[model samples]
Target: MNKRSPLDRHKQIRARLARRLFVVRGWLVLETVWRAAWPVGAMIGAYFALALLGIWEQAPAFVHLAVFGLVLLGGAGILWHRLRRAIWPGDADARRRLEESGGARHRPIDAVFDAPAMAAGASVLWRRHRDHMAETAQDLPVKAPRLSLVYEDPRALRAIVLLALFIGALYAGPDAGRRLFQALQPPFGDAPRTVVLDAWLTPPDYTGKSPIVLHGPITANKAHDEAAAPLSAPVGSMLVVRLNGGRQAPVLLAGEDDIPFDTVGTVDHRLEFALSDPDLSVLEIRQGGRSRALWPLALSPINRRASALSEPPLKVVGKPCG
Candidate 1:
């Protein structure tokens, strides 16, 4: 008998590997589908529970809502696929056995096939599955969702590390002060700042002579001068910035956007020009035909500073502020 050459052996090995890979791939898909079913079912239950509890507080806004919706849809599809396979009548042996077994005498395999009997069996199985899942999940503390670098792709890890180093240099280097460059931006783009030079500031509707008239209800008072140290209101409030230049007109600001208006003593010959407070920064300065264009202020400063002792705002700016 002629012995197989090295090439022949290699080709044979490759063929076996290919067959094994195919089998593994098939098994992986089946396992993934099977495992995903329980999670999907649990999510469905949780979704309903959340709805009942009216817990939409932390739910994502518009963009995240869409993303979560797609995720749920994908989960639903996986669950449906798994359910179909689990309940499918394709397995001839299983189907035969299911048919032969008398209803209530033994557990039903597919409820769709024999509704009444399957329903009873399903109730029992559902109860067991629910209890099992609950007991298992009880001890496992809820994990804060986070990106685990351990599972990250090598290339992505390298790129992120490189980017982070590049960012670090901007802060670590001598040119750190350059980070405050964003502060030079105009409060409103190309819009001249309106100097309210009136003695009696009348807000929209002109109901009161108060310098500020908040249209919205105050929701949360992280800090305030009011009697309630931290007054929280369901509705948001409006902050009226009283103008001093003969203009009594008050600049109405939504409380939601207003950071604690820190009195920065005096700056640029004005005691209260709404000096660039570190707590608040201008988001956008849109110009309009009206006398007073809204200066969209952000509660968190873009170039937020940090302290060794305190938890500072996540700094987007590269360097330390002077």
Candidate 2:
């Protein structure tokens, strides 16, 4: 077996050390970035959570502007404060760290690249010392980067923010993404106009049945395609309709008649009618001459049956009894 020359041995040692230095430098940069930007990440997560929960929509325009500005300023301030004193690891710094990471006391990595003095160049002891340092540098160990920010955030606020974001996302359903985008829009922009309609069927007092909700805040879908099931109500039940936030008053279409809603307030309209006609099969609500809702009506006739004595109270003529 041929042995490696001193020059080849030096090259091998330098190559191994160079690779370790590269890795350590990368890890140092990643650690610095994490420490500087984690706070911003946490803030963004909390903001998104609120948006998903629809808190932004309920807040006023001024509140929206204030919150948006606060997030930007706070994020910038955090990044600047954390990065101002950050010292990026250079090649030399990485090399030093790599050597110290292995708990070496002899400073072997430094000695391998150092040139011997003129007086020490001829000494056999110096050559042996250099050989030992080169051998030690061959198997240097690099530790994983210190990326955790627990020391900076002793309260673990990031975890809490992540939890809130997760819960809000789940509660928001498939509309969470759209809501998030909406939350980012300018507060002064023209918002979409929505009309609210509430309709219910209330049975007469003698029927003793609870009112049935035909349309309400939760079931109001402008794009719903599936036809609503026919509603079965006792005869004489009152059909109450309340429309709010519409540009025009809503009208009730029963058979061929066009019944208009009574104006209650500037934007509120109400309609109340008895479901007495058995021939009325369908009811439709219209606004601006466009059908908003349709409900098939099935009126159930009131049950009225009289009880009669079956056998004339079981004549006891048998025994005037003992």
Pick the TM-score winner. Answer: 2
Per-model TM-score versus the true fold: 0.19, 0.56
How much does each candidate deviate from the true structure in C-alpha RMSD?
24.9, 10.2
TM-score quality measure for candidate 1: 0.19
Clashing pairs in 2: none
Question: How far out, in Å, is residue 298 in model 1?
Answer: 40
Please give, for residues 170-207, the per-residue lDDT of candidate 2 as tens digits: 97776576667766763654343245678899986666
Q: Show how many residue pairs clash in every candidate, following the order shown.
A: 12, 0
Model 1, 160-271: lDDT tens digits are 4445445544433432222222112112333333232211212222222244322211221222323232222111123334322111222333333422222221110111
For each candidate in the order shown, give its overall lDDT on alpha carbons. 0.34, 0.76
lDDT of 2 at 161: 96
